[model samples]
Target: MSNARLPSFRFLIGFEAAARLGSYSRAAEELCISQSAVSHQIAQLEEQVGQPLFRRKGRGVELTVSGRLLLDSVGKSLDQIRSGLSRIETYMDDSLVTLVCPAPVVKGWLQPRVDRLLQEHPALCPIISIDETARYIDEMDVDIAITREPLKQRGVLEVPLLDDELVAVVRPDSDGQPAGMLCLETDLTSDRIGPFIREHFGNLRRLAIYDDPRLLLDAALRGHGVALLSRLLADEALRSGQLRHLAAYPSLPLGTLWISRTEGEPRLPLVRQVFDSLLAYSKG
Candidate 1:
């Protein structure tokens, strides 16, 4: 097809809308433009085709024979365009794998390894959903969920990601005092490390208690207090000399981190690829 012979798509769109609705005003309303603008575009389209596409009747318009033929062709073309666009959107959505996990896991684990995963699988997109409660995955639509909590849901594939150990961390220069205890008061911590804290730091005064590990980690980094944090979360800080590990306290075993997906749903190739990458990264 010759490029010069092609009609203005804008004009055709206006023409089709006006013709289909039998009212230029209604078309303008649907297109969010002035009624005069719709009329002007239709007039331009008619001029291009060398024939009137609409006949003014009362307050509305009627399609002429030429208009009817053009409307038929334009409608089909626009429908095809819409269908193709919809397919593209679905494909983009399919390329994304939604990962639901706690905020600490997102900050401590996934953020560090995400760039490498993306580099390896250029076609895959990972969407992170942070939920500390770990209850939303079963209630909401999620492709994969990582949680320290055991999955009670049936027909789900669960793979062990990491065995997180809890350790007391503080800023490099600090007086390890009882008043400098920064406690993370989450359900997971309460269940796993509560006894450990009582047994070890029973006389220690709590500087602050946080429900989120990320917040606890932040407080510890600022030299507010010594925080009992996941080894994974404090790893970077410890390695870089940003935070120092207190030698007096013993490390407490928290639990295993597990990545799970619904079993019945059709596992797309991209989802599998993302899961495998995450598994490998966590293991490493």
Candidate 2:
């Protein structure tokens, strides 16, 4: 706001057009205004800036040193403003809700309950973002977010979504002849689960290691090995009998998963509706 005394946006636009086109008549034609109007705007802007912004060069105009410097700053500022305006258009769309979370939650949790969500709110259009990390809920424009750690920012409300308990599982038909072990990479490095696994199942060869729990789930389903992953991620598979708890090891407590939203009143009712529905689903 320090630029409070700066010339009006209208004058800046006119000045930018004239400077870019290098001709007052061409700028006027493009702006659908009289050539004299462009001249007047330039004169007003230069007066406010305390310098001449342009000089005559044959039939066209060329920018002065001051004009070039102003153009560089004004051009970038205009672009940033235009980009914000464009984002506003998307933000105002009632059908769209931006949801951010890790990929495992999307596969094991949200995907299973999405159909019910749509049935409850047919008009909702979810923009699911699993690939991008949303470190700041307020700054990312995320209506709802699922995170491994709770956000403690002033304007963010974080609630427990799931307990990240590590469980060893395998295909139901393995018949005690399962392949090597498949484990989430994080579990292998964690203080609690890593030592437990190494102490109990040190003889079992590792078939594969994955950074994502969903991948470990798939590998277990295909009978690749006795895959170790979050119990939450394997919830659906276990419930459906596609997989079962490995009898050799007990489930270990890891961490908690959190769901968060921007605290206070929301811009739209649809955001609150989605958040409430997701919260209920997680609890159920």
Q: Could you estimate the TM-score for every candidate?
A: 0.62, 0.73
Model 2: per-residue lDDT, tens digit, 1-284? 24649799999999888988999999999999999999999998888888899999999999999899999999888889999997788798888888888787788778888889999989999988885465466633688888888778788888888877778888888886666889878878978778988987777899899987777889998988888777778888988899999866877886888887788767678888888999898778
Give lDDT per model, in order: 0.79, 0.84
lDDT of 1 by residue, 1-284 (tens): 23447789888888888888899999999999999999899887777778887898999999999889888989999999999786556545766777888777787778878889889989877768785454334423466888887686787778788888888888888864635688777633665567788888767778798877788889988988778898878767887888988878898887898888766443567776777788988767
How many pairs of residues collide in model 1?
0
lDDT of 2 at 283: 79
In the order shown, what is each candidate's alpha-carbon RMSD?
Answer: 11.3, 4.3
Error of 2 at 265 (Å): 4.6
For candidate 2, give the lDDT: 0.84
* Candidate 1, superposed: residue stretches over 4 Å from native: 1-28, 31-94, 132-140, 175-179, 186-192, 262-266
Query: For model 1, what is the error of residue 226's alpha carbon versus the real structure, in angstroms, after optimal superposition?
Result: 0.9
The candidate 1 region of ten consecutive residues with least summed lDDT is 132-141
Flag regions of model 2 displaced more than 4 Å.
1-8, 11-72, 131-140, 155-157, 262-265
